[model samples]
Target chain A: MSTATETPAQHGLAAHSHGAGTKSVKGALDRFASFDVADHSVPHGREEEWRFVPMSRLRGLHDDAALDGSDYTVAVDVDPRVTATSVGADDSRKGSSTYVPVDRPSARAWAAAEKTFTVDIPRDEIIERPSVIRLTGTSADRGAAGHLVITAGRHSKSVVVIEYDGSSSFVENVEVVAEDGAELTVVAVQDWADDAVHLAHHHVHVGRDATVKHAVITFGGDLVRNGTTLNYAGPGGDATLLGLYYADAGQFIENRLVVDHNTPNAKSDVEYKGALQGKSAHAVWVGDVLIRKEATGINTYELNRNLVLTDGARADSVPNLEIETGEIEGAGHASATGRFDDEQLFYLRARGIPEDLARKLVVRGFFASLINRIGVPEIKDRLMTTVERELAVAEELAAEAAGDA
Target chain B: MSTLEIRDLHVSVETENGPVQILHGVNLTVNSGQTHAIMGPNGSGKSTLAYALAGHPKYTVTSGSLTLDGEDLLEMTPDERARAGMFLAMQYPVEVPGVSVSNFLRSAKTAIDGEAPKLRTWVKDVKTAMDNLRIDPEFSERDLNTGFSGGEKKRHEILQLELLNPTFAVLDETDSGLDIDALRIVSDGVNRFSSGGDKGVLLITHYTRILRYIKPDFVHVFVGGKVAEEGGPELAEKLEEHGYADYVGEGAAV
Candidate 1:
């Protein structure tokens, strides 16, 4: 009878203003090192960072094998304000932007690169249309390596989309730089062939008061490992990192991200969602945030959720936050991994939606929120189609498994 | 035009130990255009009847005969039963995280109708139905039942009833969590469905407050999984004044 506004809090967790991040410091502090390749060696699956990875299947990307082949072709749809050029290793922008090797795989990618593919957005210029860069592999057996540098000049605004396709053995290093007061959006899509193997590391640096929206969408690979690090150089910077991945039968897809809040008055948010299906399908997400003692007045939160669609599919999720000082805006995280919700299924079925279609609706709905955050229609539509295809395959596999039983 | 016949229905659920019986030899008949209200106390198998008719897998019908116009209902799956024009408004509507209300409604309608609804008119039809239920237009884009208030959930159920237009509906305690205004709106929606004189409603409730607005044509007092008594609307009036104390003696049977 009365008009009352009941707006529930966005997150179900209780809001704590003081010492919120300190409470998450339960275990002994985890270690983080500077971006030095020599400090790391070939992993034998025993290290904390490399424990979840299957080392035997890496195809020597972990070791110092010569990346001696040009098995992929690079194509770009150029914008007037944006230009892509192949430069020698000595180009000022080649290694000047956020270029640092975090681990051995990245260092190997650096040492074996033939040339650098560099795309630069000039200072104070805004590009209305998005630029597209596509890499297509020539074959599956040949091993390939490459390096890429993308930079947005001071006060410039632009969007760059990088897409990967075809099948091959690949290792690559990527560097992204957002200068002071610039706004940049980078969307990297890994849509490989069924036999492709890709290992990559992406390092991003944000300048004073800059804004960067970075998204990684991974699908269609036998094995893929992607690592990203975001470090702010000045105060008032904002970064939004999003990832969506789908892993099918006998596939491994993992994303590891670290957001280092080293400056005061900055914000960072990370959200990643994945769905796994079929036998031996595996997906993993690891998020780590470190706030230095000087990084006061910071707001950060991360959420990761996984949906396992069929039997034998596995999902691993871990979120860790390390804060040196509790004097900050707020910090928290949430993670969950579960199968299809029976209550939701029954609710939809009671509405006369057949069980199969009801399941599709529920799965698609799980990704709807993250997909909308992408803010680009073409990518959103294409991702929806990809999700639908994954659901179909999962359904067929479930049927076959049931038949065998 | 249609008749939902339930005869000697017995249902049970599986617990950690073993099978546990819930309903024993219950019988009722709801013909088209009739509003029959079943009033009972908690744990008296009132909600079990609603779930049993909806073909919930957890509820095993050991012995019973449920028919929708002479077709076997007990043999059908939950979705099949819904497709056969049976509806059950749950007491606690589940929250689906990612599915939007508009998409879910469209998918359900298409599944039941055997074809996709005409795009141009379907949008208008949904708008009209939502407007009639006093539901905001933006709710169509939100996740299905997630983060919705109690009143909002009840109104959404009624919205589906108006749009889906089922032949028979089993509403289980739809008025429990609703405010007075929401109760009236939900009652009006049910009234509109039966006003067509081709749809039947089985209203399961614990209070007589909703009956003041719904105005059932028949009232049945349920106790111990059995229909203790039945009569015209006057039965509800009598029970409202006195209570089920006359029929249910001191925790006699369950």
Candidate 2:
């Protein structure tokens, strides 16, 4: 309880303090970015980033797994104004974004993917409909890797949605870049099958005066770990990151994010909420925001909230903020894990709402605002229905377990 | 007519030290078209009796029984009690984010009536009710009780009272935080509910300000977790002028 009053620096890793003009240094949890897999060591479930993740269930994604299998297919739907092309691995547009893989799986995926799917939005054009990318896995035994680069041309506005489903052992790297004065929104929906194991790293770079919105909604998959990073390429960039995941029985879901404010006068906000139910259902959220010495006048806040619906389920939330200078506008972080509130249920029941229906309402209310921010009506409606289904299934399982007892 | 009877009810709540009894033997019977006000000083267990009637899990009924029309209320869960025509306007309404007031009202109505309401008539009823209560048209679109002010929360509670149309209502300190205007509005709402001549009410309060608006047929002076005296409307005016000093000792009301 005493830790509630402690600052983020005391709760998480703290770095060295130096005067102005001092050379920059990396702190703990700040892994170096590289294209070579050798630059990153294989995780053994003991590292700071991989500690909360179940390493055994990752299916060698964090180790030396072969990533050349062609058991998955990719489909893209884009308007004639936009260009959707699959270029060679060594194309010039591959590494246009200010991002590099900071983990072994990401670096391995970057090296092993033979084709780079690129989506380019023309300059100053506002796309009427979102470009859709759908990936389906055919085999759970075979491993696959993929790389996707989406570039929003200068002052252009567009939204790209990526959907993943079916069973497979997969790793991928997604690069997003918003050029100067552009507005871009990228939504990734991970509705994989029960046997699927996936590891995804999404890196975003915001240019001068640009705005970027990234949303992640995960509903299925036996083991899923998503790592997202945000960096400002120039000054006055704005970024918003939103995530919502529901982990059912025997499901493991992890979302780790890093927001690096390297340029001045930039603004960023991160919000991720999750719900877990049933035995051995685990959910994890790790948010880190770093404000460098030169990054003045920046405003940033990160929030992570989790709701545990039943007994034997677990949720881990860690929010870390490192400030190198106090000249910024403001920076803060918040993390909280609350159980299904009995008081809420009691209030509803007193109003003639049954216990089951009341529980569904509360959970739906918990995720409503965040899901609405996805800005895609079809996706939002589908996700809402999926959440309702999940709650019903969870209740049925709880009833069965009680009957057995 | 329906009758709610509480016979020698003894209730206790769990604390760190163990069970602490809050309500001694309390006997009261409320019939349809009758309004009863329970007035007491702080720590007189006024809220406990209200919670005990609403079937809150925190308050344990150690002795006696509660029934509506000879049906045992003790055996019914909170929702069952509600479906049996019981409603409680909580002192502090819980905030449920993302659930619109319209949706919640519809769901509760469905649950109570065992079927969904007619869309056109229900919508018109809700609008008329909200308009009569002086609530904004946009109020029903907002999340239930989220970011609502004290007065707004009180009005919303009364709104539920009218929409649910229960046979009996137990209002616990509904007037504690309301201002004069909001109090009048809420009192009016309660008046409208009981005017149907087939509903019962157990209004609990610590002040007589709300009594001036909604007249009670019976007023019971509660002290030390038991009823000290029972009377009609004039008793409320008397207490308003003299205060609870006669019921409890000097400075004991604190």
* Best-fitting candidate, scored by lDDT: 2
lDDT of 2 by residue, B1-254 (tens): 99999999889987889999887888899999999999999989898888788788888999999999999999999899999999999989999888899999999999999999999999999998998789998998898999999989989999999999999999989999888988999999999999966999999999999998888999998887778889999999999999998989732532
Tens digits of per-residue lDDT, candidate 1, A173-262, equal 888889999999989999999889899888788889999998999988888999988888799999999999998988999899988888
Q: For all the predictions, what are the DockQ values?
A: 0.62, 0.63
Candidate 2 matches the true fold with a TM-score of: 0.86
After superposing candidate 2 on the true structure, give the runs of residues whose Cα lies further than 4 Å from its correct spot: A1-31, A90-97, A180-182, A206-211, A233-238, A261-269, A291-312, A321-339, A367-369, B15-18, B40-44, B221-224, B228-254
State which candidate has the highest DockQ.
Answer: 2
Question: What tens digits encode model 2's per-residue C-alpha lDDT throughout A22-116?
Answer: 23336533567799999898989888889988898887877887888888888889888999888999988788886788889999999999999
By summed lDDT, the worst window of 10 consecutive residues in model 2 chain B runs over B245-254
**Displacement of the residue A134 alpha carbon in candidate 2, Å:** 0.7
Q: Write the per-residue lDDT of candidate 1 for residues B1-254, one digit (tens) a residue.
A: 89999999898877788887888888899999899999987877899899989977678889989999999999888889999999998888988877889988999899889899999999999998888889999998998898999889988998888888899999999999888988988998889888966999999999999999988999998887778889988999998999888877732644
Between which residue pairs do clashes occur in model 1?
A365-B98
Error of 2 at A116 (Å): 2.7
